[model samples]
Target: MMRTLFDAELNKLNVDLTKMGHLVEVSIENMIDAFKHQDKTLAKEIMDNDRLINDMERAIESRSFNLILRQQPIASDLRNVTSALKIVTDLERIGDQAADIAEIILNFEGEHAYRTVEHIPTMAKKAKMMVHEAIDAFIKKDLSTAQMVIKMDDEIDSLFQEVKQEVTEILKENSERIDYCIDFLMIAKYLERVGDHAVNICEWLEFNQTGTMNDHRLI
Candidate 1:
């Protein structure tokens, strides 16, 4: 009976994680749309929605802690709960980064600031995919999918470099648009950070599955 209850709670924890992941995925999508259209209203909406993500994080944390205290989970079960705690932290940061990008969009004064860099949207798309896949890997306990998410980080980093080059060229052509270029550069950086958070999530998932991260025992 105790084992059954513990298993049910574990399943509930995963369901909450999936719900939080979906919220983050939608925020990233809305962030991309807001950037493309320079929709201040949508950007503000995304910022407002960040509170929901934060609340989810806190709720997940409490649940994980409750499981640990009540169930005294050991070995793989302990790793599972602990990993959920780490994964939620990364997911919360991803939400914050998305909100940060939205805040940048809200500050844009020119209509074409987003048009100055062509690579940011692609970078955001790839980061979003990584986050989505990482969450899926967690739910399915699929180490291969988690590893693939880690590999995808390289592409996001490469695109970030491309954005920097493109911004530098734009500055060379028109020094007056420095502020716009800088804002776009910051957006690219945030998306790059988002990719990093996704990688963190995957690493924690890997640790959960194999008891090691980067081949070093964590627990």
Candidate 2:
């Protein structure tokens, strides 16, 4: 029956999304490790692999649109597909932010440069955790998980501010390390943005489940 075929297509969508989420999760994790360790080789590898995330994004977008055309999903089904469309965009951006941070990590001359900038690793951890939890929420349809991810973003933002302050003070006291401090500041900003993208994905997840737009505060 047509209904059975449509159901199968929806399942396929889930499979593809799970694949995409896993790819992004690994990318963020590897990026953070590279940043913390100042591993240019690993950072370069993550940068090179960023294309995989982009390709998966396009593939999912195409499949989602084709399903919308062929199946004419209504109500909850329509919302589900729409949410997939939105979430993939956020997920893709998260991939980009991770790659960008990896590129910045390569600019550091040594591990000591990383040590000078306090709070960056903590920020990276919190942001990466948000992305991981948001994807898990998507896969499991766990509203509480999604809400928790949203709440977690505040922690990342707070850490970012602390990094900014610490870096500014370091730059003022140690003008010689200006360039390195600037790079760390950029990395912190990227992680903050990554956290925002995770929040966006969680919002879409909430919308997909409830058929109502959650306030940013709620999500």
Candidate 3:
């Protein structure tokens, strides 16, 4: 009877984590759209919805800790609950960074303010893909998918380097648009960070599976 009850509670925890992941994914998508269109209205909406992500994190955290205290989960079960706690922290940060990007979009000026940086959209898409895959890996408990997401971060980093080079050329041609270029650089940096957070989530998934992180055993 106790085992069944614990499994049911664990399943609910997974459900909540999946729900939070979906929310973060949508925020990233909306942020990309807002940036492409310079839609301050949609940007504001993303920012407003960020609070929902924050609340979800808190709720998940509480549930995870409660599971630990009430159930005294052992070995893999303990890792599962603990990893959910860590994963939610990363998810919350991804939500914040997405909101940060939206805030940047809200600050753009002029009627034709949206600059067409060649690599930003591509970088954003890749980063969003990493986040989506990381969440999917968690849902499926697939280590290969998690490892692939980690490998994808290198592409995101390489694209960020290309954006930096492009930005330098833009500045050389016209220093007057320095502010715009700086904002663009920041957006690229945030996307890179998003890739990083996805990698972190994957690493935690690895830890959950292998009983170690970065080859250091915690269990």
Candidate 4:
């Protein structure tokens, strides 16, 4: 009976982690849409939803530590619980990055978007995909998928570089638009950081599977 209960708790841990990941994914999608339309209402909605993600992170952390203390999980079970503790932190930060992007959109208000806006949607999509794949890897305990997530970070980084260069040209051509261009650059930087957080999650997945850390930086 005790073993059965422990197994069920492990299942719940996986479910909770997945729920947290999905919330972050939704935030990314909505933030990008809000930026594209310059919709303050949608941006506010994303910002408001960030609190729920934060709440979920705290709850998962509590549950995971409780499981460790009560069950004293051994071997792979202990790793899963420990990984949950690490993974939730990354998910929480990803949520913050999404909120940060939405806040930037809020600042843009009623202004005309610069040409650099064209690069953002694609960058956000790549970052979101990385997050999705990393979470899937965790759920399935699939090392290859986790490695793939790490590899995809490069494309997002490259896109960020392109955005920075384009923003620089825009700034040089039109000094009056400096504020807007800088905000756009910050948005791109946040998206790049989101990809980094996804990479961090994938590294945790590897640790969960292999009992070792990957000392590599994807960014």
Q: Give per-model CA RMSD.
A: 1.2, 2.3, 1.3, 2.9
Relative to the true structure, how large is the alpha-carbon lDDT of every model?
0.90, 0.86, 0.92, 0.87
Candidate 2 backbone collisions, by pair:
none
Q: Estimate each model's TM-score.
A: 0.96, 0.95, 0.95, 0.93
Number of the candidate with higher TM-score, 1 or 4: 1
Write one digit per residue (lDDT tens) for candidate 2, span 18-87. Answer: 9999999999999978876778999998887789989988999998999889986778888888999999
Worst 10 residues of 1 by lDDT: 108-117
Candidate structures ordered by lDDT, highest first: 3, 1, 4, 2
Better of 1 and 4 by lDDT: 1
TM-score of 3: 0.95
Residue pairs whose backbone atoms clash in candidate 1: none
lDDT of 1: 0.90
Candidate 4, after superposition: displacement of residue 40 in Å?
Answer: 0.9
lDDT of 1 by residue, 1-219 (tens): 988999999989989999999899889999989988989999999998899999999999999999999997879999989999998999899999999999998888757665668898789789889988988888888889988999999999999999999999989999998988888889999999999999998899888888999989988
